[model samples]
Target: MSGMTPDTPARPEILAPAGDTPSFLAALAAGADAVYVGLKHFSARMEAENFGIGELTRLTELAHEEGRRVYVAMNTLIKPGETGAAWRLAARLARRVEPDGLIIQDPGLIDIARQAGFTGALALSTLANVTHPLALEEARRLGASRVILPRELSIDEIRAMGAACPEGLDLELFVQGALCYCVSGRCYWSSYMGGKSGLRGRCVQPCRRVYSELARQGGRPQGKDAPRRKGAPHGRQGEGRPPQGRAPLAKAGGKAGRFFSCRDLELGPLVKTLLDVPHLASWKIEGRKKGPHYVYHTVTAYRLLRDHPGDPAARKTAQDILELALGRPGVKARFLPQSPEEAASPDKQTSSGFLAGKIRITPEGGCELKPHLELLPGDYLRVGVEDERWHATLPVTRRVPKAGTLRLRLAKHATPKAGTPVYLIDRREPELQRLLGEWRKRLDALKEPPAQDTAPPAGGPRLPKPVKPRPRPDMLLTSGLGRGKEEGNRAAGSTPGRRAVPALWLSPRTAELSRTLVGRTAWWLPPVVWPEEEAALSRMIDRLWRQGARHFVCNSPWQRAFFPQRLPEDADLLAGPFCNIANAAALAVLAGQGFAAAFVSPELSRDDALALPAQSPLPLGAVVSGFWPVGISRFGQAALKPNEPFMSPKGEVFWTRRYGGTLWIYPAWPLDLSGQRREMQDAGYSFFARMEETPPQGLPELRREGLFNWNGALL
Candidate 1:
C-alpha cells in the first residue's frame, strides 16, 4: 500500500466463460462485459475444446467491435522444455489476437510475457496461491496486474485482501462456479495418482470419484467391510490389493460415498454484498467446459441480480433463471465461513445436471423412462457421470409429460443397466433458440479483421543471465533434539554421522527449540499461512529474527513480507519447493524479490529438470527424498476418518493427517530421489532437501517407488 491511491468506485464487470464457439456467441448475445477463453493447449481446462490461434484472433476482433474485452487463459504450469513454445504463444496473442488480458499461473511467465513484448494486463491465476493480505504487494511486484482470488476465502477475508491490494492491481472473484475440494494450486491428488497434473490442467478429477472409507488397524485398513454401493461409478482405482487369505481387521466397518465431490458455488443474492468490497473489478463465472446453454443462462441471471438487486420482481425472475441453468445444487460454500454451510453433502449426488428420472430397461431391449419433469424435443440426457462405463448422452426425440412413461428403441451398441440414474444436462427453449439463431447469423455475417504479421523473431526469446552461484550445501530438515545443557553445546547445523547440513521446520510451538537451534539451523517456514494465521506467523518470524536467525526457507514467495524491512546484506532467503518454481524466468522474478535461492518443482521430468539449473537466475534446489504429500486441503471430510487409510474402488490407499488448521493427504509410498543425488549434484544444483515429515501410525513403510514426475512427463 506504499504509493497506492484509491480509485473512484464503479460497477464491477461481469466476466463469463467461453469454452467453445457457441458459448462465446452466447456471452456476446447476453451482454457480458468480458469473456475468458483458453487456447487448445497450455490451458488449465484442456478438457474443453479451446479455440485455435486464428479463431481466437477473429473472436478478439468481434469482442472488441462490440466494446467488450476478451481475456485469454494460458494459466497452466509451464515445464522447462515448453517455455519456448509458451513464449511464442504469448507473442502471437500480443500481436495478432491483441487480447485485453492474459491470465497466467506460472511466475516464470512474467518474464516470458515481458520478453515476448506482451503489453496486455497480466492476471495471476488462482493457482498462484496469493492467499494472505501480505501476498498482494508481492504479486504486483511479480508483474501481475490482477489477482484471481481463491474460492476458499470468506467475505471478511476478501475485504481484508482488497484493502491490502496495491493501486493499479485489480481483484477478480469467482462469484459462481464449480468448487474444487482441494485448495487451488495446492492440490496434487490427480498428478500424484497419475501423471495428469492439475497445475498443468490435465486433472482427471480423482476427487469426484467414489471412495470407501476404512478403519485403520495394524498399519493397514480393513477392506472386508468396504461396501459395494449399487450403481457406484468407477474410474482409476488405487494400486495394491487387500491382504490375501486373511479375515478383515477387527475394526472393519466403513461406507462408500462421493466424500470429496463438491457442490457448485452460486452467490445469487450475495452479489449485493461484494459491492462493498474494495478493488473488486470482475465477477467471474467458472466453467469453460460447460455448454452454451449454461453460459447464456448464468450470465443473464448474474447480470439481472447485479443490476436490480432491490427489485423484487427482477430478483424472483433471476432466481427462476438460475434454477433452470442445469448446474449442481448450489451452495454458498465458505463465503460466510463463520456460519459456513457444508459444501459437500455425502448423501447427495454431485453430478452437474438435473435428476430426470430412473431408467428401466425393458425385456425387448428398449429403454423406458418415467419422466420426473416435462421433457421436450431437443432436451439432452446423460445416463451417468463420466467415469461410469455406460455413461452416454442422448437427445430427446419426442415430448414426454411429467410422470409419464416413455419407451424408446435403443442402439444395438448402447446397453444401459436397469435402475440407472439419468440426468437432464442441456436443453434449448424456443425463445433461447431463436435468440441463438440470430446471434449465429450476425456472427456469420461479420467481416474478418485484416491479417497482421505476428511471427516471433528468428532466435526466439533471449534468456536472462544466470545468478552468481552460491555455496549453500544440501540439508536435511528435522525436529530439533535434546534440551538445556547438552543442547547448548550441540552444533545445530550438522547432525552426528550425517554429511548434510541440518535445518528445523518453524512452528509457533517450536519457539524455544528454534531459539536453541538459532544461527546454525536454517528456519523452514510453513508451506501455507491462512489470513487468520498471518499475525502469529509474522510475530514468530520477528521473534526468530531478533534471536539471530538469518538463513530461512520461505515456501511461498509472498512470505518475504514477514522479514524485517532492513535486512543484513548477507541474509540467505530461499523460495522453497512449494513455491512451484520451474524455469529460469521464475527464478529471475524471485531473485528480484530478494530471494537468494529457490527449489525447482519436483514435478518436472528428468530432461526438463536437468535443463533448468544452467539457465536459472537463482541458485536452484530440489526435494530429493521424502514423503511428498498428494495435496493440502482446508477441509477434512466428515465421512472419512482422519489418520485412517481409505481405498479408491480400484484399491489405491491414502490417508489424511491434520496439521494445524489444514489437512494433508499422502500416498502409501514416499518420494525418493536419493539414487539421483549424484546426478543432481553434477547437474549444478546448489543444494537438495530431504523432508523428514511424520507419517500416521498404522501406516506401513512401503518401498519408495514414487519418483513423482522425474521419470515421466508432467501432464
Candidate 2:
C-alpha cells in the first residue's frame, strides 16, 4: 500500500521561513513544501516582524489552499508567571490558526499544549539541544514528533542520529541559514551581560560584539586584581598604573575584532549529501528575520538540489540561484568533519549581505560611495557592523551607476570611517515587488479569523500525575575532586543543620575515582555530549550503575538516555541547571520523564526562581554559586588563545577552555548567590548548588560578587 518501493526513497520536504507577508508569499511562489513562521510573541526570533494570531490564521488557510503546510514557532522559554499565558495562547492557536505543527523549545510546553487541546505535531526546536544519536529516543519520549538537529553536527553524525530516530518521529536538518558561534540552547552571554536571555529569545547578540585580548606575560593573563607576591610592589585599585613591570591586561588590550560572529551556513550544492540520510523529514532554511528575496532564492535553490541530486547541471543552477541571496559569506560549518571550514573568521567582517563598495566620509560629514555593482532604487544597504554602534541600514531612493559616486545622507552621529564597506542586503526589484503587491492584495481581501474565547479550557491543563517530592540536600558540583575528600569534608562539617551533598562531574576517570560509596554520590553528566562521546558516556553510565551510582543529574534532558531503561527502584534523576528549567510547566514535563527534582535555570531572576516551587510538580533547586559559562562552542577562535583572558569593550573579562569535544567560554569571576541561599531555602527550594571550578593558574582572583539575574528580570 506504500507509495514507494525499496529502491526509491520519498523526497524530504523543503521547509522555508517567513517573517512577514511578502516572505510567506515568496516561499509559496518558490514551491516550498512547508513554511514556518512565528507569532508576535513567544517566538525564538523576537527581532523579526512576526505575525499576529489573526494574520497567521489567514496565512495558514492560504498555505493549505496551496497544498503546503504551515508551522508556528512558539519556542521561547516560558517564565514562571508567563506559563498560564503561554498555555492560553496555545489553546487559542489550536482553535484558530490550526497550524500543521508547533515548533517549541521548552519540554514543559508539550503536555500543556496537549491539555490545551493542541493535537498537531510538536517539533523540538534545535534550542532543545537534541545533539547526539542517543538523544533521539529521549526526544521521542519527551513528546517531540520531530527533532531539529544542531547546525554544528557533521553529515556523518546527522546520519547516525537519523538512524537512531524512533519510529513515528522525524529529523530536520539545517541546509542553509545563519550559524551561531555557540551551540544552541547553551548560550547565556546576553543573559549574563544584562538580562536579555537568549533562551527567551531577546538576544541582543552580545557574541557579535568586538572583543580585544588582553596582553599576556608568560602566557598567563594579569588582570587588575592580579595578586602581587607579599614583597612585590603593586598599585592599589584606584591607581591607573600596572603592577610594576607587569603590564595590566585590560589597559594594554590587543587589537579588537568580532571574535565570535559566525558566517552563515550555506550548503548550496552540498545539500545533495543529505539525501542519503534516512528519517530526515525536512531540509530547514533559517531566516525568519530575512527578507522575501532571500526567502525565495534559498527555497528555490534547495528545491533544485533536492529534486535533481544526480544532475550536475541542476546543482550548478542551484548554486547560481543561491548566489543572488544576499546572506553572510557561506561556510560548510562543520558539516564535513575531515575538511570542515571554520565558522568564525575574526579577521574578516561577518556582517550579512554581499559587499557592494567602500564608503568615504566627506569633509562636510557626508558620505559618498563608488558602487561596484549598479545600485537600484529601493535596494537596502547596511553601512557597518552593529558592534560599532553607528551601524545603520538605509534604502536607496535613486539609482546609481556602477563605479559612479553617489552621496549618502549622513545621520550626523554615524561616523563610519573612510573605506568602511557597505553591503547590499536587500532589494525590491519591479517583478518581485509586483508579485508581493498582488499577494498582499489577496491577503488583505481574505476575511479575518473569527474572535475566539482566549481563556484556557476549564480546570486548566491536565498536568501529569505529580511525583512525590524527594528530600534532597544542598549540592556541590565539582570535578577531579575525589569522593574521599568530599566525604571527609562532609564528615568534618557534621554539625551543620543542612550540609551540601557531593555531585561528581561524570568524566571517563569518574569510574576509577568513585570506587567506594558511589551510591551515596550523585553523578553529574556534562551539558554537551558530542556524537563521538556518546558511546563512552553511555558505557560510563552503565559502569557507574553497576557500581551502585543510583543518583544522577542530567544537565541536558537528552542525557537521560545514557542511563539504562531499567533502573533500580531507589534510583533518582534530577534535571540540572543547564536544562534551562524556568517554569512550573517544564517541571511537570521533567517529572513525567522520571526526573526526581530539578535546578531552576541560574539565569532566572530571584522573583522568577522563587515563585516556581509553589507551582511545580516536583521539588526544585538553584545554583546558588558557580562560574556559569557565557557560551559554549565547537570551534575555538584561532586568533584568540584559549585560557587567556579577553576583554569586551565594556571591560568584562572572559576566557575559554577546551573540555572534551567542545570549547566553553566562561567569565573571569564566578556567580555567587551565597548571600541568597537562605532566601532560596525559605522559598521552598529544597537545595542550593555551589559549582566548584578550578580557575586557570595566574588568572586574577576578582572578588565574587554577581547574583547573576537574581535581583533583576531575566528578559
Candidate 3:
C-alpha cells in the first residue's frame, strides 16, 4: 500500500540530489522524500565529490532514520567482462544498505542482478532512452521500477506517457538542472572531440564553450576544413552582413543568444498541473555536481510548495526565497514553446545563471543595469559586450531609487555598449550565505550522526547458475565507411580478414562505389541518415538492391517503413540504436515492419544483453570495439586550432570530426572490449568490432587495447 488512493492523487515525491555528505545531509534536512547520490566511481558525475562505497550503510541509516530513501547511481555503461564485478558490488550494497532503488543505465545489469539474486528496485536512468510509450512498456518488461523521462520531451508527450503507463510502472520527471542541448545518451560530442567518454562518465562538457558559426551567403555552410579565427564573429546572418552579394556576418545568436546552450528546465509554475497529471512518480532535481547551498535552497523551496500548494502567500515566499538563493534569472517552465527561441540562453551561453536585468548605456557612456527580478546586496553581476568577446565582473555596490538597479562606474576601461545583456552569475550575497549556514546549523541541532553497519546483511539471495558458453561466431563482420578511399578499397580488395568479412555499412555519399561491391557484401545502410539526404539514400538502396544486395540496416524508427516490408525470406532488415530499442516488445513490434534482426542499444551491459537472448534469439548485434562516439550535433560552425581537439579547462583533450554535414566528438580512447569475448559469447550476441575505414590492404586492422569497462576500474 503506497501513499496514494483511488480517490485522491498522491503528492509527487521530491527527490533531491547529493554529491557529497554535506549535500546529502542538507537535502534530508530540507525535507526531501529521497536523495540520489553517486558512489566514488562509475558515476555519471565523476567530477563530483561522491560517497565512498564504505559510506553506503551509514548514509542509508541516516536517510532511513528520517523516513527518507536513498538511491545509488551505478549508471555508467558496463562492458561484458565488467558486468560480474559491478553486480557483485551492487549485490553486496543491497544486502548491506537495502537502498530504496538502484538507478541503472545499462541493460546488462539485468543479467547481473538475476545472478546475484538481488531483488531491489531498478530505475531506468535517462540514458536508457525510455522516450515513448513502447519504450516505457519495454523497460517494465526488463524489470525497471521507474523510467526517468528525457528532458527533451514536451508536456504533451509526458501526458501521453502517463496515460500509456501500465500498472506497477512509475514515471520520473526532471524538474530543475543544467540542460544539455543534445538528447542524453544519444550524444557523442564530448567523445568525438577527444577521448573523454560521456557514456563512461568522464564528459568534458565542450557544450559550454563559446563556439562561433561560419556561413556563406544564402544558407550555405562552410566546409569542416575551412580556416577561420577563434573569436571572429560569423559572416552573414542578421547581425552584420547582408544576404546576397556580400559575406553576411551571422549572429552566433540573434536576439536568441547561444542556440546550443540550453536554459535550465525549471517547472515551478507547472508544479500543480504536473501533480494532477497522475502517475508522475517523483519530481527530481539534478545537481550532483552542485554545492550544498544549491541543494538546501532548491529542496526547501520545493518542499514548501509541495506542502502548502493552496496558499498564494506560501507560493510567493517560495519564489522569493528561490530568487534569493539562485541569483540567476530565466528558470524556463516547459509550458513555453519547445523551440530554440525559447530554450536557448539569450547570450548563447551555458548559463544566464541569475536574473539581472538588461543594461542601458547611460547618456555619459557609463552603464546602469537594473535587476530584472530580485537582487540582494553583495550579489555579483557581469557586464559584457553583446558578443561576449569582452566582459567585466562587478559587485552591486550602489543602488539608485531603490528600483533594483545597479550603477556601473568604471575607470577608463571599456564600457559595454548600450543594450548589452547583464548576467547575475555569482550568488554569494552575505545574507544568502548566512541563511544557508543557519539552515545547516538548525538541521544539525535536530539530527544525530549516521550509524555505520559493520557487517553485511546475513543470508544474501542465491546467485543464479551460469549457463554454458553458447557462441555464434558466424555472424558476418561488417565495415562502415563514409569516405571514398575506404569505399574504393572495399570494392577492389579481398575479404577484409583471412576469415570471411561478409558485410558493409556505408554512407549514401559512397553510392558510386556500391556498383563494385553490391552483390559481394551485405549492404548495411548508414545508421544516421538526415531528412534532406533521403532521396539519395533511397536511390542508393535501390541501385544496390538491383545489383543483388539482400541486407540493410534502418538507423531510425521512421525508416522501418522506408525499407521494404516484404523482402526475400533470406534477406534481413536490422534495427539501429537510434531507434531507441532496448526491450523485446520494441523488437517484436519491429518484426512486422520487416526487421529480421536488431542491434541492442550500445548502452546495454553484457549481462543485460545476455538476458534478451535467453528469452528469444533475435540476432542482437553488439559493437565490441571502436571509439564510442559521445556527441552527434548539428551545431557545426567553428574555427579550428592546431589539431582541432575539444580542449577542457582540466587539460583533457577529445577529438572532433565532421561527417555527413554533422559534427562528431569521440572519447580520447576507443572502447576496446576485445578481451571480453566470453561476456559476448555467453550472452549469445553476434559481435562486430569496427574495422579500418580506408579498406584493409591485408588483414582487417584490430583496435589496440584501451581503457574499457572490462575490469570496472576506479569503481
Candidate 4:
C-alpha cells in the first residue's frame, strides 16, 4: 500500500515549541507551521507561562491568521480521581478554543478528547516513546496522525522505523537541543532524590548532578570513607550544598562528587545526513524553557538550510546563529570522535569532524582511515569546508606491509585536504612507479568484471524462501489486585466457585490487608518511607504472587528493579512513571529489555499519541487520575518528602530541586472524562485508567454512560 495518498501533504509540518506569547510570535515569524504549548494542570512544563482559556483563544486566532496551527500540551499523568477532572478540562478546550490538534501523553486524556467532540488531529509526544512499528500501528488504530520518533535513535534505526510505519503515519525527530541520556524521556532520578516526578511534568533534572558512587563488593558496602565513584564526569557535586549553608556530608559513603552532565546536541553540520532520510517528516528544536532569541536564531538557520541544500552561504548562516544562541564557543557533531575530554565536556566547540572517515583506533594507539584518500607522512588538514573552520596537526607514525598495500598511521592530528585529486608522495622514485603501476592494474581489473547469466537458476531447494516476519503485538493485558479499605472479604465468603478479582495488593506493614482480583489493578497508597518496611512489603507481594497474583506496580524504578522475579510466565511487566521513557528510542530499548507496558507522559501531542501506539512493540498504558507528583528521580535513593502541601517558601505550589532545573507541581481540574474515553478508544488502546487517586463515586455511572472502557471492558 502507498504510504501517502492525495490527501496527505507532500511536506510535513514544522512543529515548534512556544512557552509564552513572545516565543509563539517568534516561531510564527521564523516560519513554524504549527506551535505547541500547555495549559495549567496537565502540561509537563509547569514553569512555562501556560495559557488559560483567554490566552489559548488569542494564540489560536493569531496562528490561524498566519496560516499556522496551534497544539495544546495536556500530557501529565492523571491519578485515579483526577481522570474526570482532566477529561472535563480537555472537553472545555476542544469545544471553545478548537486547536488544530491536542498533544496528549495519557490514554485517558485521549478518551476525553474524543468524547468532548474534538475532531482535530492528535500527535504523540516524545514522552510516549513510540519506537516500534507495533506501537505506531496501535496509535494509528486509535487516531494519531503523526508520531515523533525518539531523539536517541541512529540514522539507520530511523530508516527502519520509517520503512515499517503504516501509511498515513508521519514521523518526527529532534534535530537539535539538549539530548536526555535516559530512555524515552522517562526518568525517576529527580523524584527519588528531590520529590519531583517527571511523569507529572515536574522534573528536577538529577541527571545533571554529580554524585559519588558507593562501591559495593559482593553486594556489601565496602567501608566508611570508601573512595566515592562518579556516575559521570559532568554531574553536580554533593547534595547541592543544601538550602541554607553547607551541611556536613552524611556518613553514607559519599565519595565521588557530581558526574552526569552533557552538553546539548547541535546537528547543523550533519543536516545533510538528516535530510537524506527519506521518511523524516519533521525536524524539532529543543528549548521550550529558552527565550525567543534562541528559538528565532535556530529556526531561521535551519529554515535556510532546508530551503537551499548544499549552499555554503546558507550553511554559514546556520552556524553563526547557533553560536550566538547557544552562548558557547560554537557547535560540533558529538560522538564523531576526538579526545576523551572533548567527548565529555558540556561545552562543545564547532568541528566538521563527523564528515571525516569514521575514526578507528588500533592497538598501537593510532587512528585508522576508512573510505577516504590514503594519507602519507605529512598532509594539511582542515575540519569544515565552509565557515567555522577547525584546523589540526597530522603526522604519520608507521606503515604496515600488506600483500600489495601500506597501512599508514598519523603521528599527530591533521585535517585532510578537501576537493582534491589524488596526491602521491614518494620517497623512492622506482618504488613509487611500481606501486602506481600495480594500483592501476588492480583498478582496471575491478572496473571490468565477468558478466552474469540473464535469468536465475530454477529451483534447487528454492532457497527456502525467507518468511516475512509478523508484526509483534503492541498491547498486552494482565491481572492485578484492586485497592480498597475492605480486608479479605473474599476469604470470608462461603461460595467456593465465585470468581475472585485477580490482582496483587501491597499493604502497609502495619495494616494487614489481603485480597485477590483478576486483571491488572493498582492502588496509589502512600509509599512506605523505611527501606526495611518496603522490603517486607515486597516479600508480601512474593507471597501473594504464589497465591495467584499476576501483576504488580511500584512508584520508583529502584523499587521495581529490586522486586523479586518469581511470578509466572503470564505475568505482565510495567515500568511505572518513575522509569521515565522520554523518547521513542528509549521505549524501543525498554521493550527489547522486556517491559510489557509503560505509562506515557502527558506532554505528548495527539499525533504523538497515535504514533506511539503504532510504533510501540508493546502495549501503551495511560495514567488517567489522582494527585500527580511533580518531581522524581531514578539515579539514587534520595526521595523528596513533601514537608508541606502546595505551599513552599519558593513562592510556588510544589517545587523540587533534583536535576538541574526546579520542577513545579500543579493540580489538574478535568473538564470531561467522556471526551478522553473516545480519544483513547480511537487510538486502538486495549487499556486505560486513573492510577493514583480514588475514582469519584459517580465514576461507575460515568463509565456506564460511555465515559471509560479498557479493551472494551467497562470500568
TM-score for candidate 2, please give it. 0.92
Assess the local accuracy of residue 210 in candidate 2 as a C-alpha lDDT between 0 and 100: 82
Candidate 2: the clashing residue pairs are none
Better of 2 and 4 by TM-score: 2
lDDT of 4 by residue, 36-104 (tens): 888878887877777676566666876776788887887765543354566567666766677887776
Per-residue alpha-carbon lDDT of candidate 3 for residues 50-145, written as tens digits (9 for 90 to 100): 887556567777678778988888887654345446766777766666788888776656555555666767887876656566555555656677
RMSD of each: 5.9, 4.7, 11.4, 23.0
**What's the CA error at residue 110 for candidate 3, in Å?**
3.0
Which candidate has the top score in lDDT?
A: 2
TM-score against truth, every candidate? 0.90, 0.92, 0.60, 0.48
Pick by TM-score: 3 or 4, better one? 3
Better of 1 and 4 by lDDT: 1
Provide backbone clash counts, one per model: 3, 0, 44, 142
Model 1 Cα lDDT, one tens digit per residue, 1-715:
1122355446678899999988898898899999999998889999999998777888788888899999999998887777888888888888788998899998888888888988889888989888888888888877788999988888988999888888878999998889988888888888877689999889988888887765544533234322122211111111122222222332324887787888899988788888867788889999898888888999999999888878888888888988888888898887887778777777898898899998887777678889899998888888877556557888888888999887755566666778878889888677777887887787777666455453454445667787555656666664433343343333233333434555666776555664556766678887777888888888877887788888899987778888765568868898999888887777777887888889988888788888888888888888876667788877657887676667776666677767666777777566777778678777778777776544444444344467787788888
Candidate 3 regions off by >4 Å?
1-9, 214-259, 307-312, 327-341, 346-349, 352-715
Candidates' C-alpha lDDT: 0.77, 0.80, 0.57, 0.46
Pairs that clash in candidate 1: 219-698, 237-650, 238-652
